[model samples]
Target: MSAPTISYENHRFPPQVIAHAVWLYFRFPLSLRLVEEMLLERGIVVSYETIRRWGRKFGAAYAKQLRRKRPSREDIWHLDEVVVSIGGRNHWLWRAVDKDGDVLDEIVQVRRDTKAAKRLLIRLLKKQGLAPKRIVTDKLRSYGAAKRDVMPAVEHRSHKGLNNRAENSLCRCENENE
Candidate 1:
């Protein structure tokens, strides 16, 4: 029996530089080719394809690591839904956030009914391992029913201007997607 050989090539620039180059590409609206040109100016010439690969590999890894390190604490969770278009079909983005504006969970669903709202809440609670003490939501009747079904003990607030935090978070996500 024979074993396959593994080889590693050391990069000319440090890992941090390569990681930063990829991070800047996604953190802004610039195209990959534009990022390549910017890196060229810094005396580190690399192709756009290479940068794309690095970003896909490292960006997701970094995000996952950062999420794992975050603390899970019980707090007020603001919940909201926004209309979105996916593949020419209307969808809704259900989002939950903490009082300090940290995202707890986000899910895309085909409807905004009670069942959908319940599913979103269950997913968020399961993933975060904590039920919100206070849930702030818009005046969506579905939210009232969902809260009653899934978390009857949790306080629910549904005032017109009170859910601005979650609404603003949805707007930020929408703007970034655009």
Candidate 2:
């Protein structure tokens, strides 16, 4: 499929410069002024306000293009669950990621049991439209039980070390809950 094109009509800067600014702003954890400084360092003069405008105008097109790519059936999914505290209560955040560490899906639920695991697996299957070649997770018995019910044919690997990809995909804020 062809990639979606972003229009840069009536802009003072070239398409490359504008695209770079927007990319820098979204691709990193940088503030708008930081992005402005980054552009200036590259000999491109642009205001942070202009950069913000370009992001607001063109960011959706970039995001849409990214969301168009689908997970492959050959992908090995790494699944992990973390406990997070919200409003003085504990919640489970189930997350799945491919070998490349791209998040496939995530859900926040009250329980971290077999039912929750099944829900995450079902969501992943429906969204990806295919079962992964294999699934890896920590030594969580819920994963094993859920996999048997949701996708009994796929290979399941349960090991703490093997699930680092999914573990790293979790945000630092969730880690702080421990």
Candidate 3:
């Protein structure tokens, strides 16, 4: 199914200006006021609350379009898991990244067993519509176990040093959350 078209009716600013403001706010880590200031520098006198409203109205559609524009799947995938504490409870964050260090998929689950790993693999494979030539991960036996059942023909490289890309991606995400 296709995404619904965004309506730009009943707005003072042109569609281009509104779209640019929304893009600036979501495509970067800048705050709403920062986005407002940047737009003001361009002589577009708009309120931060207006920008926030546009983001709330159009953010998901913009993100959906970006996801639809993903390039071809990489040949190698790096899979990793990390434990995170939330509300005094522990949850496992399973992530899959391509060779270029771009996150392909992620899932948060309570368990980090073979079943969880398999779920990640299945979701990745379904989303990508193709299995990578190989997958690298830490010395996690669950990954190996899941790989056998999900994509047995794909190569599995289990090494601590080989999966720094995935580890670093997780680190960056955690840092952003803090």
Clashing pairs in 3: none
Residue-by-residue lDDT tens digits, candidate 2, 1-178: 7765787889899998988898889999999999999999999999999999999998888778766456677889999998989999999989998898788898999999999999999999999999999999999999999999999999999998999889887864357677
User: Poorest 10 consecutive residues of model 3 by lDDT?
Assistant: 66-75
lDDT, candidate 2, at 98:
89
Candidate 3 achieves a global lDDT of 0.92
lDDT score for candidate 2 against the true structure? 0.91
Off by over 4 Å in 3: 1-19, 22-43, 46-74
Model 3 over residues 1-178: C-alpha lDDT tens digits? 7778989999999999999999999889999999999999999999999999999998888888777445353579999999989889999989999887889999999998999999999999899888888999999899999999999998999999999999999898879999
- What candidate 1 gets wrong by more than 4 Å, as runs, is 1-73
Give one clash count per candidate, in the order shown: 0, 0, 0
lDDT of 1 by residue, 1-178 (tens): 5333322246565786777786788778999999999989988889998888778767776555445434344588899998888999999989998888878888999998999999998998788777777999998999999999998998999987999999888778779999
Regions of model 2 farther than 4 Å from truth: 1-16, 20-68, 171-178
Best by lDDT: 3
TM-score of 2: 0.66
Residue 54, candidate 3: Cα error in Å is 16
